[model samples]
Target: MKTPLSPKSTSGLRGEYAGAGDDFTVEQDWQSYSPEAHDRWRRLYAAQSALAARYAAPQFLEGLAKLDSAGGIPRFDDANRVLQAETRWTLVAVPGFIPDAVFFDHLAHRRFPVTRWLREEHELDYLVEPDVFHDFFGHVPMLLDPRIADFLEMYGRAGEKAMAMGALDMLARIYWYTIEFGLVREEGGLKVFGAGIVSSAGETVYAIEDEAVLRLPFDPERVMRTAYSIDNFQQNYFVLDSLDQLIGSLVGLDFGPIYERWRHEQPLPAGQLQAGETPFKAVRLESLGERTP
Candidate 1:
């Protein structure tokens, strides 16, 4: 028999929906979407696709192409056909952000919870909360890559332990820095792999081009101890040398010592380097003979 999903509070969630299961999943009901919604999706796709080609990681670009989502909001079932084949991942519709444990449970099982609603047209450039466009467009493409696919499952598995240890804050920072706002060195320059960067047109340019923002080399411990900003563009981005390094760094690694050591320590401020730390100098896009769009 299937385990019953426990009741969860919906307070602070912004997505409009009804009939969510105990797990907070709802049917995509793809046909119910209005033409205006589809058009909004198309506009978002058109604008972000251009930025992605210029600034996004090759894996993201390849995955975006494979998903074929440029026309409108993609049917989850259609995208699942490709996603499941590529990485055994599938999208499940949800009203919005669910509880952390529920969210982690879905990831642990390779079920990604995508919000079932789209953002308003006026809110295109920025939305305070993640809408379907942010979840599906920004996140699902990376799920197609095996490295990220594996890492996310591992992350989900780690969540329970984190919660029990009272270390969710530390674990969440890892997710925030790497999965949501990560940068990677590719083609002799920095390219975005983070979903947060890929989905926002303004941030796509700002993340890579802005001289004011600090880019730091990926250090799991430092990342966990660092604070992040959700209300604005990230002041700091963690740069990975390669996806392989990201996987290898955390696989079979114990976070116990790190958490124990730093759990009581004050969080490092975002955007400021600690004494004796040096920032990573990104290879300029112009140096690679690529023009910014």
Candidate 2:
């Protein structure tokens, strides 16, 4: 992968934010997409859907069915039709990434900001920055689930407050380990749920099936103190038993004191469990040597 990370932040939208002032939203420019771009969308959507059907959460697949964007690049208006009809959520067009404040505000209001561009033909296997396929294909489908929808909205709201406490790093970790690369247990087996995993072909294979990456039960405090990679497959993937439990995890967070206590601690290594946690035999990797840094 030639990327620094998947599209984690909304701030990299380049200069297109100039006109939107603080909101940073723009038209989808649905007609401006070249035939080649749409073709890229078709190919990526086909491949990812096939892979995700096997690895993605059931609700994620359901979202894709509802959105109906598998055959080609979907118009923002069209996707909104389904999103609004089902979840009362909508996709907003953006130029690549947007500022965090703007991004959170959009999410807080049930609006998902999707980038309107596609990755180049040359970088099909991997790209440095997130494209339309990653944002929409990787993420949108799962938004249909009520718990995830509500959880994300709360995340955005809490995130806005966390920023004032100078604890955005702690908050971003929650988004990273949960929203971008989270796993969930189903039928006693772990399955992929994070956007960063389902969208990437390699990760879709490596995350659940690899047996090389350690899987730990979700712990918000541990997740906040842990460091993660922005450039490669993750060494540690957190697992949540259910969406209700995930939402429950945030019920009584007093992040200020937690942040102050662990804020300056050395980041937990990506490949190792800390002192308080144990490597359950069922979730431990098959070969620790195969893990990444």
Candidate 3:
């Protein structure tokens, strides 16, 4: 991968808060996409779907089926038809990741900004920043759930609040661990809800089956206090009992205090156990012990 980290810009869209100097808008060239571009989407879709089917959360899989997303690159208009009816969420086009505020603002309004660009064929397995496939296929399907839909809006506002308090680093941890790399326990077994897992074949299984990754109970404060890495496979996967459990706890939190405490605290390394003493086998056995009957 020559460039795993791709610079994403928000395409200019009139927003109530958009300022003159903001460089957030991403330019789109929808008509310029070639046959190879669409094929890449198909190839990734076929590959990731097979791997994720066993590892991904049932909700994510069900929503994906509801969206009828097996086809190649999803057209925003067609995707909106199903998404709007399912959760009233719409996918809008952006060049890439928009500015923090703009990104949050769009989510607050239930408008998800999907990059108009797809990853190159060689870059299918990974892309540093979110691309169209990451945005639409990975994240969009989950919006079909009513609870998750509301949670994302709240997540956006929480992000804005974190920015205002200069605590976005803390807030990003919450986003990274949950929205990007979260796992959930289902009747059958551990399943993936995180977009990062859904989009990557390697992570889809590693996040759930890898004994090296710590599977912690979902606590908003713990998540906010925890630090995460963006450049590699996650060393920890926060496990949620359910989406309701994850979102319900965050509705009333005021993170200013949380961030303040985090400032003085040392961040836990990716695979660090609670007390930082355990081999992967011990950690796995401990996890099995914590589950409910």
Best-fitting candidate, scored by TM-score: 1
- lDDT tens digits by residue: candidate 2, 88-136: 8899887766656777788889989887778888878886577788888
**Cα lDDT of model 3 by residue, 145-259, tens digit:** 8988888888777766777777776777877887788887777357788888889888886776676567787878777667677788887777887888877778777678888
lDDT of each: 0.87, 0.78, 0.72
> Considering every candidate listed, which one attains the maximal lDDT?
1
Candidate with more favorable, higher lDDT: 1 or 3: 1
Clashes of each: 0, 2, 6
Q: List the residue pairs that clash in candidate 3.
A: 10-24, 10-25, 10-26, 11-25, 11-26, 12-25
TM-score of each: 0.95, 0.89, 0.84
- Which 10-residue window of candidate 2 scores lowest in summed lDDT? 1-10
Q: Which stretches of candidate 2 lie over 4 Å from their true place?
A: 1-21, 280-293
Ranking by TM-score: 1, 2, 3
Residue 291 in model 1: lDDT: 70
> Tell me, what's the RMSD of every candidate?
3.2, 5.2, 6.0
